[model samples]
Target: MTLEVHGMTEIQQLAGKDLGRSAWRTVSQELIDGFADVSGDHQWIHVDAQRAAAGPYSKTIAHGYMILSWGVPMFAELLTVSGVGRSLNYGVNTVRFPAPVPVGSRVRLHASVIDVQPVKNGGVQMVRGFTFEIEDCTKPACVAESITHFYP
Candidate 1:
């Protein structure tokens, strides 16, 4: 479920809030290939199914960055900010890929608002913790702390 917050006031009150998990999204070979095409990272382990079959993972794997980029859409499924002038992706504080996301796997995001601080111009800087959990996997595919600034 999405947690909708209207205006800066509601956003500011979200510190330490648990946003919960998002819907599962499948990782397809086509998606991986598209990412490779756009990123110019056509490594055989990611695009060549034939060779990847003999690789350690025994199949094509999605790029860590590709899964990281999905943070935007995945987060949108958990929270919605409204009545603000703008919401900007400030940056990522930390990120790590603990496990590979093999093709045909499913991933979901578990997000929490870790901190919210008042910034200049009456805006708030929110630090959100995101964990990209791969289905049926013991380790998470990626863990990251994303920062965003919301202006009134």
Candidate 2:
């Protein structure tokens, strides 16, 4: 769903609402490998399948950052603000890695708008709380609260 910002007041009113969950994405070895290559984090646990199979996690696991990267697109799917010319990612208020995301796992995002307030220059600062859940897992892989500034 697209978030249309009819007006500042309407956007502000979205605060305290739960945005819908995003589409499921499978975490594959290729994705993990690509992330490792770009980040230069070729840790054995994330790249070496055999070693990882014998390691504590029992399989290659996705990087924490890789999971974090999924948040943006997921948030976009959850909320679309209309009437806004631009939006800037302010920063994250908090982030926690609650559990590991194993390779081959399917993950999805669940988000909620926690707070909204007007900023200078006719912008609105929104705080969104996100939980990234691994399919069929009881614990979430990541939980974070991020802030963004929307220029209306």
Candidate 3:
């Protein structure tokens, strides 16, 4: 799903609604490598497939931040508002990595609108509560609640 906002006024109306789930995506080695390169975090567990095969997880896994990156896209699939000129990422209230997302695993996200409040300059601030689950896994890979500021 794609989120399109024409202005801030419309965004204010979606402050506290369920924004659906996103499509499942596979966690690939190439994605891990790219994230490692960009973040300078080439941890063996995330980049060394061979070595990681003998480690506790038994396979290279995605970085926690990489999984967290799906928050916006996943939430976008669930909810969209018209009339928003622009939006800004304000901050995150909480973030937790509950499980490792091994390479080749599929994952998806679930999101809900937690709060929406008016901000200065005719803007609105919205918060989303998110839970990310790995395909076929009982435990969620990540749980995060983030805030976004939308300007009219």
lDDT (CA) per prediction = 0.96, 0.90, 0.87
lDDT of 2 by residue, 1-152 (tens): 64555767887998998887899999999999999999999999999999999998999999998999889988878777677788899999899999999999999999899999999999899999999999999999999998988886
State the lDDT of candidate 3 residue by residue for 56-137, as single tens digits: 9999999999999988877777777666677898999999999999999999988877888999988888988889989999
Global lDDT of model 2: 0.90
- Candidate closer to the true structure by TM-score (higher is better), 1 or 3: 1
- Root-mean-square deviation per candidate: 0.7, 1.3, 1.8
- Top candidate by lDDT: 1
The lDDT of model 1 is: 0.96
Q: RMSD (Cα, Å) of candidate 2?
A: 1.3
Instruction: Give the clashing residue pairs of candidate 1, or none.
Output: none
Q: Please list the residue runs of candidate 1 whose C-alpha ends up more than 4 Å from where it truly belongs after superposition.
A: none
Worst 10 residues of 1 by lDDT: 1-10
Which regions in candidate 2 have their CA more than 4 angstroms from the true location? 1-4
Who is ahead in TM-score, 1 or 2? 1
